[model samples]
Target: MKAAREARSAAVVINAGSRRGAASTELAVDAMRRAGVPVRSVHPVKSGTELFQTLRRVVADGHDLVVVGGGDGTMTSAAGLLAGTDIMLGVLPLGTANDFARTLEIPGGLTEACAVIADGKVVDVDLGWANGEPFLNVASVGLSVGVTEALSPRLKRRIGSLAYGIATMQAYARHKPFRARLEFPEGDHEPMELEDVLQVAVGNGRHYGGGNIVSPMAGIDDHTLDIYAILAAPLREHVKIARLLKDGSFIEHDRVYHLATRRVRLVTEPPLSVNLDGEIAAVTPADFSVQRNAVHVIVPQSSNSASFEGPSRH
Candidate 1:
């Protein structure tokens, strides 16, 4: 244990709407108390608005750390408060996917995750912004926005991560290619246009849409956003690339464009919904940027030594 250096006094907020919220919160509270953190308050919020209001109160009350229990959506809602602030954020993955938690190498086990928070190895990590809105994991448009719209809570509970894959297929069938231009103003790259764009995902962390790897070498601490664009292709070609993506080797696929940059902008002919983390947060034309080392997060010691794959230029 590293002596709970960054988080001595803390407050916890659990999203009552989360699938595992109630059960996970009880276990997390007991674990936190055992880990020597004096939990100043514990709140169960029914909506993102309530969760953020509670978090603001917690920060005002002098709590140094805020432990949040929910899925990626809940995290994204509260990200505005935590990112670029002195307050440290601790996550308890109690929602579907929990993609950001996966990126941090945080265990899903309640007791194990608590131990990581208790041991307290805090480090800085990047935050992704979509149209001025902050997100912890990834933000996307096109197929993903459709997937988010169609995703049912019942399906998520029954099939877990597979639900995303199923929804992807369903969304893809109804999806029409949209024309979009991507500009990397900060990186000084030429604006690129795609006549047949299916989906564009910008990842602040490595994993998104469950456990799928956005970029093999992407890391939260790397200060760069990983961009993955899946263009319109034949069903057969899509199938082949899906296989490669499953193996974290999709970069070689021509239809799949990959870029690593600090900032970029996506402009569509007609504005499209942008799914940030897991919820539809904003709409394009959206500006995506990275706030380097903007958040302090607790993680296991081994995570500090974890290696992330970098962009592989083809």
Candidate 2:
């Protein structure tokens, strides 16, 4: 295994509320230690508020690396605090979906993930912003907000990734068409307005919605955001697009408008909720942009989703 130049001193934070978090907290620390990581501190948080405080505390403590465990929502919180800093992040995927971890090619198992953190290379990755709040995966409007609302903790813990499908079905039946105005500040594309839209999403990383590809060309280190808006269509056509979402071919359909840009301003007709990662964190008229190379993350050496810019690239 290649040696990482990042400091061995690290702190760990895990959201005990996540699906596998409570059971794996002790295991994660032990694995990291066994893998030769010099863990300095640990925090097991149970709520978003507690997580926020714990991350802030860890950042304030001046540790060179912080190992975070949880899903997309949990990782997003760490990103906001660690962005634009030298504090490297080690990931342990312990939540449902774990889309953020998937984008980085981090393994899902506890021991294997710790091995990556111990021996992986560090790289810079982009983060998406919504009204100044940082998000790791996708920030979405309309239908996704409904899906987030429908995805109760119980449902996720019981059925795992299948929860996304069941929640989508529930949200789909109650979905309402809305309108959105899109403007690109970089002048990459002309401003446009669309009506009867099912959802509008801006993706910072590739995989989301339990491993659904954002777009065929998407990458977390690409320094661009992938934007897409799905307009309502006839029943048969809508079903076809839905079937293609897993691989991001949904963007090829006429009803699905897609683009890649540095920044975009979205204005909704009635100011609907925005789901950032998995949390309802912002509301439209929200501004979305890519924070290029904003996070220093450790990934498996064999992973290619992001560029190897950290020490020990060879």
Candidate 3:
């Protein structure tokens, strides 16, 4: 226990703007201290830009581990700073969706999450890149981008993950079909084009959009990104596809196109907004690639989604 406690020194950063952070911050800090993990600092950040800067400072100050408490977007913002370094990233999952946390099998509760960090099992995982930014879950355009743009913070705090569904419905009503071309750029695959594409989601991990599984077999350690593109079809057909997606069987649908590749470039007619792990990452005419084993994360030993490789010492 003493060896594990001394394995990595940690600093905690809680995004105070997250829905549950205010309620869970004290509890999380207490749980970590009780489990004997040495916490060097605690920071409460108000925005993604602030969180990113704070994370860089924490790493620079010699802390080898950073326990970030927020939703997927906040965590992904930190990944841009922590990627390729030897720092061990720890998650607290105090957000509305926590989609990336679901991918990691990190517990939703503060106590269990803090306990996982205390256990100190580290594993290297793949990262999805969209126009040079690193993301742990999905990078998407079309309908999901509209959803991110329409989703309000008040609604999110009131209804949590259901806020995504509400915003999605509204986005769908206003969504327009657009031409999309997908190219391998680096992988061994031919280019593909679609006439009317409603949405394109490239997933590095299994889940996105508040628990929707973009690909059933996708994993952060798999070294590939799974692409799910929703082709424009009749409303009835879309309803059927939506049912399959809700059932976690969207892969079997015909109108949905799936690809697993090392790198991809997407060109859309008239440029669209792209959401990465729930935040607006970039605009369309974008490039994406997989950074295999780019970041190390702390997870529980029992987590099937991520296997424990060993301890990380920087």
Candidate 4:
């Protein structure tokens, strides 16, 4: 645990892209000032490495907390640096699908989010890793990757989640099945050939693909990872699954398989494209593992109940 003086003097780093909320970066700075917390610095980042570099500087400067203001991708990028460290991460949900923020019950509005941060109740959260990259939401291979690849930034900003919905329709028309072998650390291996598989999502949190609830029962503090495999199906079935997801009924669907594991290795007959926390990573065969209690997060004390509740696989 960091000392009180250290926590109060912590610096916050916000991704400029996360500036969509009404409480602009200026308000964040002003709030920090009002709280009598010194503003170490606020830096803008364009790519993943840049975010890491800024985080490193913040840590080296003895800042006890690192606050990120962008969407999931930006948060994932910064998470790798804070894992296993003493720095408490504060999130300002400014991205398209603030899935992590939603799970934490952090409001979308910046002012509310900042108020939560100012309260400064710290929580320990679990983070998952694919190879070495940190992902707070989910990572997957197959149709979902196709949809992510097809959606342009302009379309995403203009249409929001509708862009992914449109991409799913287009991807469904071009879907094909593939053979994959999933090997768990306990020596359980399952080899299956799938057709029209929407995708395979390995979730650390409960949401992905723009609030699609890829792993409806996932818990961030749990030491396990949720692996959700969506087999390719007809357009009608795919639409049905999408609808079921909103109501938390997708878990009972026949085409979906959910597993809880500490580590998983995926091998595909043909190389498959993969997305890690919404960012494209190398193609399959990928190795995934959970880093238990991997990072410290600054969350509201009021949300403590939900934070510790184990993930539901129902």
Candidate 5:
């Protein structure tokens, strides 16, 4: 994938449904071209189906670069298509929570992001997989899934990043505790059974839930998945934990169990929806693995996030 691309052109795909997607599409296209990238095709797609088709076509067309605009969900979709391939991804963070972009230190402004695409270096980043679906940030079950359901488009457009907090609170009231077991495939840890869990999350990248850290030690290029299972607790205790979420110190709480491994398997009593980034990508009885250096992307030259050398695919 490190080899030179025969055609050095780039395609841009922006998800129109995202908060700033519709507003930023044309600006992104113009700014990218202005930044001196070899821009070819530009698409402001309104649906996931269209976004999929457009990304597939650009890859088939042999474009050297694929510039994706929108949130984590849109980036997750693009990663599924572009991972393990030679094409480089240029991100435009135009959604409510640009979690993946934040992990890479890719700024939020259209002009700044475009500049990075044009002048940045390429680096390989890991993607977490749940039942074969790819996610650039955290993937989880339980209350997080409810939060995803509560995040309506109108609500996000109105409150921006604050929407995540509002939705989490709204979902918390209706969250149902579930039972589950975790088995580490690498045998790094003994299998464990658990009961009445608020959430079980497997994180590949550091930032999620807007700007919350998965763990202080977690990193997208770390080649390991960060796993955390928070035991359901009393309201008074949970409020204290919520305060620690922003700094990822919540993982140190007595109720929050944390581990880092290459892979793990999660099984729930009554299969529950799994939230991958923001989309419900899978259900329980899930197999989770770290796709180490699964995707190559552009990031600011000043970013300390990923290794500049490309991935060595096994």
Candidate 6:
């Protein structure tokens, strides 16, 4: 199939704290100008509402593409607004994790990302929703949620992925699993009452939290969500799982349960914490579904040919 037209007029939105946001915007603007593509507007947003408003303004002004400069959170926020719309979404990876970009095989630097956008080649990608919010990468609950929530921005910037490692250690120290009832689209119900569950991750893209392949077999073009339930195991086993995840071998580990479905209902007894994309959304008893081909994304040709490995902990 022929790719969609590259936008001649684009709106660039950046999340200020994204590691490379400012530089990426500069690079993109320069590239667009070089290609003779007019930049309709540039918005640097501080909060989620501002981001949404900026997107609305850009769409209202008839901008053909929305180029986002930030990490997974910013991309996920933009995807929620532009999905099912004619406006194509382009990404400039400035965030720490940049999970969506990795899944699309978009290079890490701003210049390369700008070149991809200038080259066009838009394709439809699947999006996942948890309680009505769109998530382009992964939504996780349980231990991962607690760890991410407990982490401070200072820790993340100063130590990078090590922040997650520290937080994971702290969380595991207090680890306890609750009873959960999982309902699948096919009317099958599985009740799990365990003493230890590390986390449950629902993946729209194969990766999240700075390149962890939480769902190795996930495909963005496919209309399905890959689910992983990381059970609590011995500390040594957890260490082994973490190591395997880094090398893309965690999916086959004995402690992890993997499933793929379009919809899942999760009900937990004590209400576990939930993380959507990288941000905390809510506690348990959450409903999730996959919206097939819900958004048009600009991706490198390599993304279409690449296979994904499941997520791992840093």
Q: Give the per-residue lDDT of model 4 (tens digit) for 1-314.
A: 52222465667677765436334678777876686655677776656677778878887887777777788888887777777777778888887778888777777787778777777566667788887777888888887777877778777678776887888777767767777777786665554445555677788877677666655567777678888777777768777888987645686789887778888888776778778877897578888888777667767767742343222220
| Residue 219 accuracy (lDDT) in model 3 | 83
TM-scores for every candidate against the unseen true structure: 0.93, 0.96, 0.94, 0.89, 0.96, 0.90
User: Model 4 misses residue 285 by how many Å?
Assistant: 0.8
| Model 5 Cα lDDT, one tens digit per residue, 1-314 | 43213228999999999999988988888887776888888888999899899889988998889999999999999998888787889899999989899989999999999888888878899888899988889999999999999999999999999988889899999999999899988899999899999999999999999998999899999999999999999999999988998889999999999999998999997799999999998998999988777788888888888874565452
lDDT of 2: 0.90
Q: How many clashing residue pairs appear in each of the predictions shown?
A: 3, 0, 0, 3, 0, 6
lDDT of each: 0.81, 0.90, 0.82, 0.73, 0.89, 0.75
lDDT rank order: 2, 5, 3, 1, 6, 4
Tens digits of per-residue lDDT, candidate 1, 1-314, equal 12345466789999978878867777789889987877878998888788878888887887788898888888776666776676777878888899888888889877888888888576676778887898878899898899997789888877777788889889988998999899998766778898888888898887787777887787777878888888999999888977776445786789988888889999986789999988887988999998876767777877862322222110
Q: Given candidate 2, what's the lDDT at residue 101?
A: 90
lDDT of 4: 0.73
Best by lDDT: 2
Model 1: worst 10 consecutive residues (lDDT sum): 305-314
Residue runs of model 1 more than 4 Å from their true location after superposition: 1-3, 305-314
lDDT of 6 by residue, 1-314 (tens): 22424466778898877666655566678886676556778888777778778877877887778888887888888888777776778788887778788888899877777777777577777778888878888888887776876677677667766677788888778767766667786664454454456778888887777777865567786778888787877789888888876445687889888878888988777787778888887667888888776777777765672322222111
| Pairs clashing within candidate 2 | none
Better of 1 and 5 by lDDT: 5
Q: Once model 1 is optimally superposed onto the true structure by TM-score, how far is the C-alpha of residue 175 displaced, in angstroms?
A: 0.6
> Over the stretch 1-314, how does candidate 2's per-residue lDDT look in tens digits?
12444575799999999999999889989988887898999999999999999999999999988999998899999999888887889999998999989998999999999999999998888888999989988999998999999999999999999999899989999999998999988898999899999999999999999989999999999888999999988878888988998999999999999999999999999889999999999988999888887888989999988974533210
Q: How many clashes show up in model 1?
A: 3
> How does residue 299 of candidate 3 score in lDDT?
77
Error of 2 at 297 (Å): 0.5
Q: How far is candidate 2 from the true structure (C-alpha RMSD, Å)?
A: 2.8
